[model samples]
Target: MTMFRTLYGMLALCTLLLAPRTLPAQAAESLRTAEGTQRALPRAPRLPRTAFLENRTLVAAQLSPAGDAVAYLREKKDSRGLWLLPAGGGNARMLVGSTQADQLMWSRDGRWLFLRASRVLSIVGVDGRTGVRVPLGGTERRRVMKLDTSQPAAVLLGERVRAGTGERWRIVRMDARGQRTLLREDAHWIHDVALDAQGRIVALARFEGDHDALYRVRPDGTLREVLRLRPMDRLDLLGMQADGSLLMAGNPGGNFRRVMRLDANDRLQTLHQDPRGEADLDEVVIDPRTQQPLAASYRSTVAATYGIGDAQAVVADIARKLPDRDIGLQAGSGPYARWLVSERAPTLRDPRWYLYDPRNGNLRRILDDPGITANAPKEATLAPKIAIDYTASDGMRVHGFLLLPPGVDPARAPLVAQVHGGPINHFRAGYDGIAQFLANRGYVVFQSNFRGSTGHGRSYTFASNGDYGNGRVQQDIVEGVRWLLAQGIGDADRVGIVGHSFGGYSTLLGLTFQPELFKVGVAGAPPADLGWSMRWLVEAGDQGDLPDRSLRHTLQALSLDATDRATYTRLHAQSPLVNAGKLQRPLVIIAGGADRTVAIREVIHYTATLKALGRPLTLLVEPGGAHSPVDPIPREAYIFAMETMLQRHLGSPAPEPPGQRLRAYLRENLRLAGPEFAEFSSHQRRNPLLTDNSDAQE
Candidate 1:
């Protein structure tokens, strides 16, 4: 028997409390209508709602040229921090000493470590020496930019604004001594900067509009435009080559991007073509481990770079020497070393890393962080991922993951539609909390990479064009539910939906627009109204509160006349609030009090409407939660509320106390058992934050 069978009593109570009330009214009106309204039997593979979130962590330690040490990041408890270990091997030391610090960069000399925190830039020495803040002059304006440091003693590209005037950025000399000297200032904004071996700078400058021109500038102020991207042609720089050439990764004349080498004489050569049907290269890092380009990391970090040269064959040949693990390309430092062919080992779940050493066709586990299974719970296991495709309403193929629960009847699991954020960002095949938590409680979670999701081609992404907050995206989600039902994997009568941010918006729309498909919904930090969000963004200025400029431009391009209120009203009609009256399902609306992205006012208004309607709506507000729940108390409280809600609605087990259950789940599933588990459990016992804020939001 599965875990859920033991909790049927809890499921019965939820069904009795939240059942649709109009059933009796319709039953008396007409026999035919009543028959049509009868709930369908639960689908097979009704996965449990409990799953584990596999946090994305950085591994595969590599030392710099000087080999003082190699560093990697360990992501646990949702806290990401850097740790340094001797390159040859020894005890690991914490680098930043705090999870808050990110973006670690090692200078060529390996003597200095640079980091960008918010808008400020600082460097730390490797010797654990005291840190010093580089002098950034001026009290009003921020630095325009920073120099590309591949070259030695790189200059600082910065702009200092006058008290009451606009500023022009000038290139300034910056050395290890922290000295500065003005170089030049111009009207154009520098899009990219790369330093050549000789200390000359190659800059990608954009004039008015989309016109980008590449220029080589010497310290003496001599400048020359080596290549120009015409208004008609699309050309962009990836980085600078050691031989003074430019590495370009954009489509000048093709569907997919191919690595192009542009010489000083303006001639172009194709180095490598991107894999078919995959996202184009965003950036490439030369592998310092092998002196060859090892990996190409994409925006989503789902994809990686591979060597097309002899190394490809060599990696395959070397794979024979290693365990039967999945070998793939990984991204990081220098040339010839471009693709760090790696083997992902699942027995460790931590995925033991193996470096692709082409010279001897050998693969070796680089650095291993063995999964500590001692503390993990026995009941909670890592969710199983299966890749599948479903056809959308428009006949477009949609790809997604079906996260199944462990040891379940596959025939009668409840379903939770887990929508991912970005609406544009696709779901990667990894462990996540929101989905796994639902699975742990006996709900089959369907994570879709619907239309408008990235990692696919630009065309597929554009399908979401003008569809922002439109019915199209919602239909994709709705169709996903239908697809699961078609597969006989989820019970339609027990389906629920939940998401955060855009995912939250999808959740709202999913409930409001297709109420019959799901019995309950949870939307966290969702934008209730798109129009209000746009206005809020415009008012936010440069605080990153608004959508990307490209998105704003696309919205206008779709003929959304901003001058006309009717246009705004028509678009606003697509919001969940406008159709809230159509919703008959229960919903949990959660929000952070200080969310700068989506104002709390909008959520308050939506919940106010639901309250006025006397609907079965539960609202969870976090006093300290921003767009994402970070504070441990609020986050745990959120998990508890969600678990209890699912238990109440889907008829799963009565939720264990938030603190006890969460501690157990974390320990059992995350392998955080024994003393560490006791420590974490005691810590939670001591902190009343989660329960303390439960009534605060209400």
Candidate 2:
């Protein structure tokens, strides 16, 4: 907290702490012009850099419960608000001043739209009324448990409030009419809830410090424990089945989630597990009328939805009607029930919604958001992604998605391995802007859901336990690329890596440990040393008691123990920064100057060390950004830098030059620029540490 430490702590990172410099007017004007000097490569489709950088929600619409209208949350720049409209696309009943909300759900009665913006919950009447707003306490966390359309306009809300030293869950009911009722309050956190057809709480699953339990809500309003699981096991109360049993998803550690039935006598029966036994059962579709899981989704090589009981035929019917697109079904109210079907494809930037009457097999397209479609790249100009799987070096099977540029020969395309951020997330079937942008430039994009990634069953996720920093997990990615290369999917010699956060760390590892394989790396807010980052997280990252997902416990299970000295030693030995001398490939690091997760100081120290070693590296800092820069200026600058480096190394497409504002940003915030970025900026300042004639080394 002292000024002395704040200013001088990172002073050693550079030989000189030069004052900020503004770009010359001439340099700025030059940058405002299109295209860079390196136009020797194949010309790619010209799209605005903003096309790849826009993260704003274009629009989200949900089919009304009555299946006669659609509720729209429009976020177009000029039209930023909520609106209610008819199913046939008539006039909109706009709700003024309600521009942003975190999540959206329709009220049960189809008269309102439930919106949550941080701690505040608001409901907008479809009649264009001002609506009712309810705010929670400042320091509380809430999860919307359920919104059953068969009932009234009430919601089952789980509010987590600070209790003495720990936190407790207060389950409450809030309706569109502004009525609030306390259903039940418990000491542990309520993770899931199941309600009956009449809007009554059937059961609730709570996760405590060392164990989890499912409690049945008795008729007298008391709670009875029906099922309990010890630490590391999973328990989720999906809903109440028709046979008076509690439908659930649970796993006894090891990551393999299974669907089961817990009868009134507390007898458990296995219903459905991933058929391949390698993917977790996610995306449970609940019946609005019966309040039970009708279908569930799992991801292996690709994502697939398996229906439960009578729902299997309905899902099959939808598949026959709508082929080649991922189907996301949201239940709606009607005679035979209408399904709000969202059709998603690899090239479709936005999910195309359809009103499907399962009874008569009737389907109709409903959404046409101009905010996205107006700026979205042409469908024919975009690439297509396919689910792929390959065997790794250790004989374990790995699955991922690959995006190929349209009209480009797979045998000749350059390769870019796009690693995902969460060591918990995976590359799935979707329209990814980054992958599409890369593919649009004629690079064969490979994203491997390496070991330690979720979506695949628990065993695969737990397979990388203690293997982090040891090359097993990284090998999965490398092996996948090698397999693809063998299939003539990409050029073996022309390969680069890019990612953010953990994926960023993987990018650095590829450049450092496998420099001969990967020619360049672009890391966004990378944690240079995994062990150090974990240690910092353990000490300073958590606000209160560590949650299950905090990596306090999961880190030890997935990789190394954060508090163990031996674990730190092993992790540091394999970390990129500690092995910076091994990195011979070009690297461009884009960092948030004030990143709390991966401290900016860590990035500075790593780049400084590389500079001392005379390594070819560049550092781009977004001073006002955290973790990653969401603002267009810094983001475009990053894309430009990455494209330039890749173009220079791999013969990829040339990038459009940074715009006027981005040029100024580069001149000021590009703390370190190398020869790769020489064309974009007049100021190419290499550290004195990089030259042998210079006196300063450290």
Candidate 3:
């Protein structure tokens, strides 16, 4: 009997030992099957996230003017350096491996490469024979652009700083002998400086009051304005003609950009224009081999996708000459000769090298990154477009991009009017997932290029100059939503609003001041009170109190300020946190703990106000994130939290991830006792047994 009992115990122990290992395998198998089933479920089609994910890392690509060799800045987390690769396509080798090394450039001859590391600039021989620092001879503040060995001279441009009422900039020249010469000086910045074929120092560009103008400089420090701009005209000096005329691009008379030539006689000749005129003058180049206009590339705003039509036509005409050639736009090159003029092709890393044969318009597509072509997403689940116009508070015609759901009929889509952050920024038409992601689950996304937004004229861009966190900016967003439902594309009943940074402040103001519009609200890194933000602005380099900081002084002069401190306090009371009790919809707030710009403490105070109001809200704090949660991990966390909250309020489909238990735990337990939950709860409260019944009942 004793032996039999001992055998039974041993068998029980063996079963215990085997069960744990086998259970995981069973669970993993079940998980695989469940995931497969979930994926196979009949659902709206979406492209693999690989399309956006692959290009997430942006390296500074430097290319030779001839497009034969390339160098780029590569960063793997904290580690960063320059990597060199053949322009025609080959293995990339690390030229400089130190983290601080960046700003790689090729000399005019393309025989050598230069990189800036801290205070020192290192030069590399293309043949891998010599590497040394070229001694800088100009003032400490002056910087040089290294040219080719054939030219053997570098152009030095100085920093422009406004002193008192005058602007001061120093332009200098340097040679291989490490000798410096003060070539020219200007109060305004010299925008474009290039060595002509005759080795003449030409100052073809200058920045004046938010406008660029073409200028010429004699070898002596004398400046001559070659072409003056109209109040609305912006000059982008393309390059020099072989005969010494300047090639410039800008919309001189219309809304769209057009290429034009400023001849020796100062005649502006129009080159080409698309009907939609919203074409972006990407870059311009003349063919050194042929001494003719090589090619010009432009990106169309999503609102006016008609620009792509011209691009397609131009490429089709080119393709007729070279049969079976797919073309892409080369991103970066020099003044003469573009790399690619092919239509619908992905832009090369350095877009400037794009060369189109002006004689025949034949595109040269070299250095094809097949990985991009092979993995490029072809799915049509891009951001939707709704061209709507709204009368701003000032009665200006404000055009905005209203993105609706991918598959939903326009009539059934919910609204999520997302205000872009840069009050100075504009949202162009493009394939953006954030808009599509909101839309995919069923929500109409509205992105506006409000009054402060650019791509409009300078007058429109600086309209909201001193009006940060004021009513004018907030009204633009409010009026945008009213225009949407007015168009009957959005369901006014189910509307949510969201924004980030400055946009985040607008989102909060949209809810607090105009509570009836948005049914649900989210503000990422928003500044709550204007007074605190004003103080923050002062502390964070607003320079309003300082005398020498003229830009800040100029900006301060442009803003709408209270006549007195008392009036400013009245403005503060109108803030989102001042009236948190008015929030009718669920609110979600996200803040980065390490945020330096928009203080995380401001968000915390805002959330605290909402919490005090007894309103349901979710607060997410990214640990190592900053005011800009540009990092992938934290951004994903913020996006997930936001989507989950928005889905909860607006009834949109949730993304597949974050298992049910985890989601539930976040919703139930991490509601507000974030990070400090364990410390905050007592023994009885911490015990799941005690709380389980009460939580279930509640």
Candidate 4:
């Protein structure tokens, strides 16, 4: 009997030992089931349209020179004002109410806030009691070039005025007593000016026709040319270092712009350069007291900063803790350093700001955009952008960003080739509203940095300078799409193209010249006839307050050759309006009624020609919209129209229409003037862009 009892006890102990191991497996199975059920359930409702369109409530937050107070611009409804808050904890107070003041800078003594209001330089007391405007002498726009807070009483100003058939640039030093001293004047445009700690002009950038001349100011107040950039090259002077050496950014020998220091002896030393040749050194962080470079930021696939010293090393460590966000040094140094870190991702509707202090080793949330945080969908997933590269037809390497919808098979997804404006500009990895919105709705978004795009070296830029509508520039985009299709990342049957300004021109070209590649096109502020647009720019030069010489120069650099009639004829041939009959796909053209950059008349004429030809096109006009729509109502409406059109053409599941409030706002703000306005109604026929392709396989 004792042996049997002992055996029973041994068996029970073995069972107990095995129970924990089996229990975890069972729990894991149960958890998996729960997650599957959750996935089957409907997702959280999407945020309202207005939630994405509202302007930022807080912006341009800066710390006081003493680091005892913080000042920021606050916008509520239609009112924008400056507000101050004590760092030690106190009630925030409005310094100035109902003012359009911006570009806030603190005085050296921390007693005044210097700002620009209505194109005039002004200053107000920190207590919000006294206000004074620096008499700039004329209404001709004046820009604050450099403010020497160390001196506390003087500022460098760039004054623009009309010269004989061109614009003349002048640099002046203005004191607190309203006394102005002219420093230099030139017929060529002055791009920027830099001042030393002693309130002396140390460096200046002058645009002289084909190249930018960078000049150094000597101790005798004489200007000497230090460097001259080629026609397509870019150069920017940051500031004078503690040793009086000039810190500059440009690509002198390499393909990328790197931070370099130029000494008085004309010797150039490289301070920082990114390993990726595509990155451009953007901004240099300087120590206010020592006037030295602490860190510098460069933008490649995304913005990244590198520390030049131990003090900045701590800041870089803190930045690494917060992945996928851009960190900026707003003000202060050492233990009292304050940083403005932005959380910008495609999944986020708006950016969130944070303030960090190295002394306390604490990162505190300062501002959360109410529009995004309060209204974002609970189940929305953030999409990831992948950096990609492809070879063009001529074997030129091209780079681009690709965003695919989460939880969807990219092979079966419809693709939108979203081109950026500024055929001169290139797209960076960040929170692009349009790309995110489209990806959220199940469309893959691809942004290509074609040959003409910046950040790829001067040769690449010059390659696209004269090749606007046709040539290798357009072929680069075509090859990109074909490469994606060949990789099975895009559904060839359902593809669309969309762009703004110069991008709009590319969209028109794609639809007219390569109709088989796209099923739909959406263009905003596109210049249809290059020749007419150039002429209009010259004619409208006299109507505006600014000079037109820059516009003429731009025309000469891009699509014009004043000496060749054949070149003009080739440019005219590239106009989509001349080949409206080839537009077999559905197209939507958006125009800003008040757009001065690309006149509304050009859009009107192009759409009128398409309408006359009975092509499948829709035109939506924003009555008082500028080149870029800023008003939330009209902007949201424009997005909604694009969404609806894409859904119909791609055969994707349509989300809920714009809420009643949004629809009412759109009706009040946007004008539906196209012949097919009825097609945009609640009950309308499927457009020609929506073709039934049941034979397409995944």
Models 1 onward score TM values of 0.74, 0.85, 0.67, 0.84
Between prediction 3 and prediction 4, the one with superior TM-score is 4
Any runs in candidate 4 off by more than 4 Å, and if so which? Answer: 1-45, 88-91, 117-120, 134-139, 161-168, 175-179, 334-336, 369-373, 376-380, 538-551, 554-564, 658-676, 679-698
State the lDDT of candidate 2 residue by residue for 46-138, as single tens digits.
677677764455456677666677776767654467766676557667665556575678776777888876667787776766567777545
Better of 3 and 4 by lDDT: 4
- Between candidates 1 and 4, the one scoring higher on TM-score is 4
* Top of the candidates by lDDT: 2
Give candidates' CA RMSD values in order. Answer: 11.1, 11.9, 16.2, 12.6
What does the lDDT come to for candidate 1?
0.55
Instruction: Compose the digit string of candidate 3's lDDT tens values, residues 383-420.
Output: 32433445654556565665544446544567888887
Report lDDT (CA) for all predictions.
0.55, 0.70, 0.54, 0.66
What lDDT is reached at residue 294 by model 1? 37
What's the C-alpha lDDT at position 155 in model 4?
Answer: 70
Model 2 segments more than 4 A misplaced: 1-46, 54-57, 148-151, 160-167, 195-202, 217-226, 230-234, 241-243, 250-259, 273-278, 369-372, 542-550, 679-681, 684-698
**Which scores higher on lDDT, 2 or 4?**
2
Model 3 worst lDDT run, 10 consecutive residues: 1-10
**lDDT (10s digit) by residue, model 4, range 1-698:** 00000100111100111112222454334323332433344432444445455346665666776666778787776888888877655667888886677668776667778777655677778866555686443655577776664476567777777876766778877765567888777776687777777667778887766566788877786788988765555666777776768877778655677878888687888878765555667667666555567776665445566777655665666666666555555546444656555555444555566666667766766655453256553325545555556666565667677776666666678999998886768887655777767776778888888887776666677767577765678777877787777655679998999989878888988999988888888888888866556566555723222331254555566655423466667767777867778887887877787888788767777776676677877777778778877777668767777776687788676756777776665544333333334434544334222233332111
TM-score of 3: 0.67
